[model samples]
Each structure stands twice: as structure tokens, then as C-alpha cells.
Target: MPMTVGALRETAKGERRVALTPETARKLVARGLAVIFEHDAGREAGFPDATYVAAGATPADAADVAARADLLLCVQLPPADRLTALRAGTAIVGQLRPNAAHDRLEALGERGVTAFSLELLPRTTRAQAMDVLSSQAAVAGYRAMLIAAEAAPMFFPMLTTAAGTIRPAKVLVIGAGVAGLQAIATARRLGAQIEGYDVRPETREQIESLGARFLDLGVSASGSGGYARELSAEEQAAQQAALGERLRVFDVVVTTAAVPGRPAPKILTAAMLEGMKPGALIVDLAAESGGNCVATVPGQRVNVGGVTVLGPLDLAAGAPLHASEMYARNLLNFAGLLVRDGGLSPDFADDLVAATCVNRVGEKQPQLI
Candidate 1:
């Protein structure tokens, strides 16, 4: 018998995307897996119940789908009450934030469910198709630049008109990772003068390659995995001083500095905000993780001294259709790699699986809190 794959409706508030798309469901079915989905799971994301059915997936209630599934696919961490629905030995895949959901992961493990966190997917050529973080971050980066542009009082491109000449907006991006690089590229396309900074020295070239100037602090602050490490108190002070002096020059700043599983490092202090020109704009992409700017409030916009600071938490969700498409592609790639010969296999020896799987084998409780 073929193994069963199931997708549940996202229970998280404001989540618009289903874990699987109808197109992906059909592809999975062709690969010999029976696909099941919660009724109306894809409706909000623009995929209808009839669409999934047309694609060869059976629509069922959440509990029934979970009960029959050999592999459970979700867009977010499973809710506590839903844990009871998962059958023993089921393989689950989703954006299970292990640091935040450690207890829930432990519970899933206790229930004998093998749970995988998509965020832990390794950055490698072989795993590119399965990289959920990069897919979502690409959407976020594009959105962040647009948001910053909208919040700015002036236009992004320079204009020479009969009335007067308008200067182009100046943008500074404070990270050179996937999101930061995308922001730089987007801003440049809009005719803005863009500059980028990152703790990882190697990213300087990547930033320059995007037609953005690279801003160097002349200090080493990167950690393993090419992420920016936490700065020492004195180093942080010096960095802040340098940023403050430069802050007044830029018309818009998009900060994407964040360390995974940790609070966003404070890059723009209150004093720095005060130094910025009146009507300047700041978009903090790391707002969900506390924020890269001191005054940023997650999901809210604030005005500090005459500068508008926006901290949007769910940027990808704001662009639901495309975001869902990208996420479904990544999830499909991951599931295809793990399932073989008509059944799901938890190959702990595989680097991709081992790094992403958080639960131990043969447990009966949730491990993600």
C-alpha cells in the first residue's frame, strides 16, 4: 500500500498559506503517495477545495487527515490540542521553531512522531530546492524594500522635470544575507542610491555585485555558519557611533540584521534615530525577533523624531499567493527526498534529515515547546 501524506489548515492567526498547493498535491499523487488535506486548507491561499480534489487529493477534517497520514505537512508549528491527532511513527515536516517550540517538539517525540524543522535545512547546493528559509526570505526582502520606499516622503528615482529636479532616495541596508541582498537589488532597480553592511566580510563582494556600495566597520563580527555574531559591549558602542554618524545622511534605512533563534541585535539606537534627517524612513525586517532598531514595535509603525519606523512581522504572508507557491515548492522537494518506495522514511544518517530532525526516535511526547 502507498503511504499517506496529509496537510492541515493553518491555525495560526493571520496565516494565509496552506502547507501544500493543489499542483504539488497532484505531483505527490503521481509519485505514489495518497494526498489528504483539511477541508478548505488552501482556500485562503487562493487554492480551492475543488482544486485540490481535481488534483487527486481527498479533503477531510483535520483530525481525520492526521489520523490516516504517514507524513504530516504543515505551514507552522502544530497546536497543542492537535498533537493528540498525530499517530505514532508519523513523519512531520514544518516550520517548527525549535528554540521557541522545544517543549512541543519534545511532546511530538514522546508521541513517537519524527518532527523536522524546515528552518534547520542546511545551506548547500543539494538542499537549495528544499531551503524554506531562503524562499520566504526572498519574498520578505522584496517586500521590505517596497515598504521602505512607500514610507519615504520623496521618490526613489531622481527626476529632471520642467518644475524642478528631484534627488533620488538614499537607502542603507544593514545585512548582506539573502534578505539584505534582495533589498539592495530591489532598491537599486528603483533607482535609489543603495549601500549595504554586514558582519560577514565575504558578503562585501556580493553587496557590491548588486550595484550597492559596501559599508565596512573595519571589525570582524561574524560567527560560524556565516551569521553575524553578537558584538562585545565596547565593539557595539563603536559600531553604534559609526552608524549614528552615517544615519543622518541616508533618506531610508532597511535593517535586516538578525541571528537565528536569538533576539535581533540592536543596530539602530534611539540616539541614532534622533540623528536621522526629518522625514527619513526605517524598515526593520528583524522586527519579529525583537527588532534591529531600538524603537521598532513588531507589526506596528512608529515615529521617532520625524522618522517613520515600520516593523512588519509577516511580510511574506502579505504576498500570500507567491509566498505560498515558493513555500510549497520547497516543501515538496523536501518531502520527495524523504519518501521512497511508497513510504516515508526518517533517514537520520542523511545530513539534510539529521540536521533538520529535532525529535528522537521511539518517543511518545512532544519535543517542541
Candidate 2:
């Protein structure tokens, strides 16, 4: 019998992305794999059960897929009840933040489930196509500008009309990672005169390459492995002071700075928020990790005087269709490392696979055995 891989509807609050899209399901089925998905798994993402069936996938409830599947594809950790029902030796893959889910990790290990958390994938050329963080950051970054344009009372583009000529909205985007770059590009496309800021001086080229004027606050915290180092207290104070003075001009500020597995660095302070122009907008993409702004409440819109600050949770889920497509493609590429000729016989020593799997594969994964 062919190896069966299945996905269930995400139970995470406000999550709409599904691990399996009809397109990816068809590709997996073409590889001689059996695709199973819970009923309504992709419905929220605008795909129906009929679409999965057309792609050669079987429609099953969560309980049925739990019992019958050899592997589970997911976006978040499966629900506790679903986890309890999973067969011993089944493999699970997703952005399972192992640190925050210590008890769940131990539980999966005890049940001999091979848990693969895609977020742990190493930074390498081989892993780029399967980098969920990068793909999803693209979604979040693009959405940030859309949110800013909508929430801001002012128009994004300059206008010349019988009424006076209005200047373009000034947007300053903080951070230069995938999300930050996308935010700059999207804001520019919306006709906003935008600038991008990052703690890493090396990113000036990347930010400017996207047609955005790079904002330099005279702070650099470049770190190894393409990530920024945490700023020291003295440097943080200098950065905040420099940044607060500049916040008054920009009509829209978007903060995308984040460190994986760490609380988001406090970039926008209460003082900075208070100094921004009245009727301005601040969109914090790092809100899920406690926000880059001291004033932002994760998943809520807050009013600081007349300025609007939004900590949008699951912003990618807000654009579910394309987000799910990109997410499923990333997962499908990563799936190549695990599923072999219609069965699971992954090489445990493979760097990409070894870096992601958080639990022992037991005997089902012959390489681990």
C-alpha cells in the first residue's frame, strides 16, 4: 500500500491556512502517494472537498485520517485530542515551536511520533525552497502595507486635482528581512514615499534595491547566520532616542523586526508612539512575539491618542488562498526528504531533515532504526 499523508483543519485560533492545497495534493498524488484530508480542511482557504477529490485525494474526517495516515501535515500543533488519537509511529510536520510546547514534545516522543518542526530548518541554499518562514513573511509583509493603507485616514498616493495637490503618504518600515522588504515594495507600489530601517547596516543595499530610501538611525547589530544580534542597553537607548524624533513625520509606520524563538525586540517605545503624527498608523507584524511596539496588544487595534496601532495576528490567514498555496508548496518541497517511492524511509542524517525532526522516528523510519 502507498504511504498515506493527511492534513486536518487547523484548530489554532484565527488560523485559516491548510497544509494541503488541491494543487499540492495533486502533485503528491502524482508521486504515487495517497493524499487524505479532513472534510472542510481547505474550505476556509476557498477550496472545497470536491477540489481535493478532483486532485486524487480522499476526504476523511480528522478521526479517520488520524487512524489511517502514516504522516500528518499541519500548520500548527495538532489539537490535544487529535494528538492522543494519532497512531504510534506516525510522523508529524509543521511549525511546531518545540520550546513553547515542551509537554507536547515529550508526549509525542513518548508515543514514538517523529515530530518535524519546519521552523528549525537550517539557513542553507538547499532549504530555501522549503523555508516556510520566508514564504509566510512575504505574505505578512505584503499584507502589512494593505492594512496600513486601509487604516490610515490619509491617501497613499499624491494627487493633483482642482482641490490642492496633496503629498504622498510617508511610510517608514522597520526591519529588512523578507517581511520588511516586501512591506517596502508593497508600500511603494501603493504610491507611498517609503523608507526601510534595519539594525544591520549590510541591509541598506537590499532596502535601497527595492526602491526604498533606507533609514539609518546610526545603529548596527549585524549578527552571524544572516540575523541581527540583540542590541546592548546603551545601543538600544541611542536607537530609541534617534528613532523617536523621526517618528513624527511618517504617516504610516510598519515594524517587522523579529527574532525566531525569542520575544520581539522593543523597537517602538511608548514615547515614540506618542510622538508620531496624529491620525497616523502603526502596523506591527511582530505582534505575535509580543510586538515590536510597547503599545501594541497582540491581535488587537489600539488607539494611542489619535494614532492607530494594530497588532494583527495571523495576517497571512487574512489572505488565505495565496498564503495556503505558498505554504503548501514549501511543505511539498520539504516532503521530498521524507517520502520515498510511496513509503517513508527518510535519511535521518540528512542535514535538512535532522535539523527539523524534534523526536525519534522509532523503527518506522528505517534510517533512524
Candidate 3:
């Protein structure tokens, strides 16, 4: 019998993106695997049930899909209560943030369900096709700039009107990762004067290529796996002092610096907020992971001394259609490693498979291979 793969409707509140798209489902079916999804799972993302049916996917009840499938795919982790419906030894793949819910992970492990967390995918060229983090970050970054532009008092572009000439907004994006680069590009497209900064000096060229000036903070924290190393206390203080002076001059500030499983570094302080212009705007992309700004409140916007600070949560979720498409493709590519010709089995020796396996069936502890 062929291996069965299926997806359930995401149950997380306000989460609109579906785990599987009809386009990706068709590819899996072509590979000789049966594809199943909960009815109306893709409706919020604009793909109706008819679309999945046309693409060779069966739309069924959520429980039936969970009970029948050998490998379950998801966008958000399924609720803990729902795991009891899964058959023993069923494999699951998703972001599955281990840090957020150890109890749930333990429960799934004890149930003998194998879990794969894509967030742990190594930063290697070979893994680029399956990089959900970068794909979602691009969407978040692009939307963050628009969010900043809307909240700012001044216009993003310069205007030459009867009222003399209006100056363009001065924008600064901290962190030169995929999201930061997209933010810089979007801001530039909006005619803002953009400047980008990162602790990695190697990013200077990338920032320059995007037509944004790169700020030299005289500090480098380049680390393994394409992430900036955590700065020492002295280094953090020095960086804060130097950045505070420059930050005050920008009309819009967007901070995207973050490390996986770690609290975001505090870059903007309360004193710095008081120093900025009266109507300056700040968007903290690291808000969910404890924020890079002192005034950021995870999912709320607050005014600190006349300056507006926005800490957006799940910005990618706001762009449902494209985000779902990108994320679905990423999951499909990763799933390819485990499903071959029609059977569900993984080559434990493959680095990608080994690195992503959080918990296998019957294991007492997670194998951080």
C-alpha cells in the first residue's frame, strides 16, 4: 500500500495559512502518494475545496485524515488534545517550536508519534529549498515596512509641490538578514532614504547593493550558521550608546535582529525613545521573542513619549495566500526526504533528516542529531 500524507486545518487563533496547497498536493500525488486534507482547509487562503479535489487530493473530516495518514503535515502545531486521534507511530512535520511547549512535545513523544521541527533545519545551501524561516521572514519584512510607513506622520517619498519640497522619510533597518534585506528593498521602492546595519561587516556589500547605506557600528558578532553571536555585556552597552545617537535621527526604525530559541537583544532603550523625534515610528519584528525595542509589546502598539512603537506578531500570517504557497512548497521539499516513490521512511544518515528529527517513536528524549 502507498504511504498516506495529510494536513489538518490550522486551529491556532487568527492563523489563516493552510499547511498544504493544491499545487503542492498535486506534486505529492504525482509522486505516487495519496494526499488528503480536511475539508475547507484552504478556503481562508483562497483555495477552495474544489481546487484540492481537482488536484487529486481528497477532502475529508479532520479526525479521519489524522487517523488515516502515515505522515501528517501542518503549518502550526496541532492542538495537544487532537494528538490523541493520531495512530501510533504516525510521523508529523511542522515548525513545532519546542521551546514554547515542552509538555505538548513530551505528550506527542510518549504517544509514539515521530515529530520533525523544520525550525531546526540547518543553514546550508542544500537546505535552501526547504527554508521556511527565510520564506516567511521575507513576507514579514516586506509587510513591516508598509506598517511603518502607514503609522509614520510623514510621507515615505519626497514631494515637490507648491508647499516648497517635502523631504523623504529617513528609514533605518537593523539586521541584514533575509527579512531585513526585503524591508530595505521595500522601503527603497517607496522612495525612502534607507540605511541598514548589522553586526556582520560582510553584509555591507549586500546593503549597498540594495541602495541603502550600511552603518558601521565598529563591532562584529558574526557567528556560525549565518547568525550573529550574542554580544557580551560591554559590547551590548557600547553598541547601545553608539546606536542611540544615530537612531534619534531616523523618522522610521525597523528592527529584525533575532536568534532562534533566544530572547531578542535589546537594542533600543527607554532613554533612546525619549531622544527620538516626537512622531518617529518604530516596528519591532523581534517582538514575539521578547522584542528588540524597550517599548515593544508583543501584539500591541504603544506610544512612548510621543513616539509610536509597534510590535507585530506573526506578520507573515497577515499575508495568507502567498505565505501559504511559499510555506507549502517548503514543506513539500522537506517531505521529499522522507517519502520516496510511495513509502514513508527516512534515511537517518541524511544530514537534513537527522538534524530535523526532534523526537522519534519510543525515544525517552529528543534526538538532537
- TM-score, candidate 3, is 0.97
Residue pairs with colliding backbones in model 2 are none
Overall local distance difference test of candidate 1: 0.87
Worst 10 residues of 1 by lDDT: 360-369
List of clashing residue pairs for candidate 3: none
What is the lDDT of every predicted structure here?
0.87, 0.89, 0.90
Q: Write the per-residue lDDT of candidate 1 for residues 60-95, one digit (tens) a residue.
A: 998898899999888898787875888898988989
The alpha-carbon deviation from the true structure for residue 192 of candidate 3, after best TM-score superposition, in angstroms, is 0.4
Off by over 4 Å in 1: 361-369
Task: Report the lDDT tens digits of candidate 3 across residue range 1-369.
Answer: 778899999888888899899999999999989999999899998999999999999999988899989999998889876667888778899888877766787778778777888888989999999999999999999999999999899999999999899999999999999999999999999999999999999999999999999998888898888988878989888888898888878999999999888889888999999899999999999999999998999999999999999999989889999999999999999999998667878888898988887766454433322
lDDT of 3 at 202: 91
TM-score of each: 0.94, 0.95, 0.97
Candidates arranged by TM-score, highest first: 3, 2, 1
Candidate 1 lDDT for residue 128: 91
Candidate 1 is scored at a TM of 0.94
Q: How many clashes in each candidate?
A: 26, 0, 0
Model 2, 69-113: lDDT tens digits are 888899989877986778877888888887788568767878877
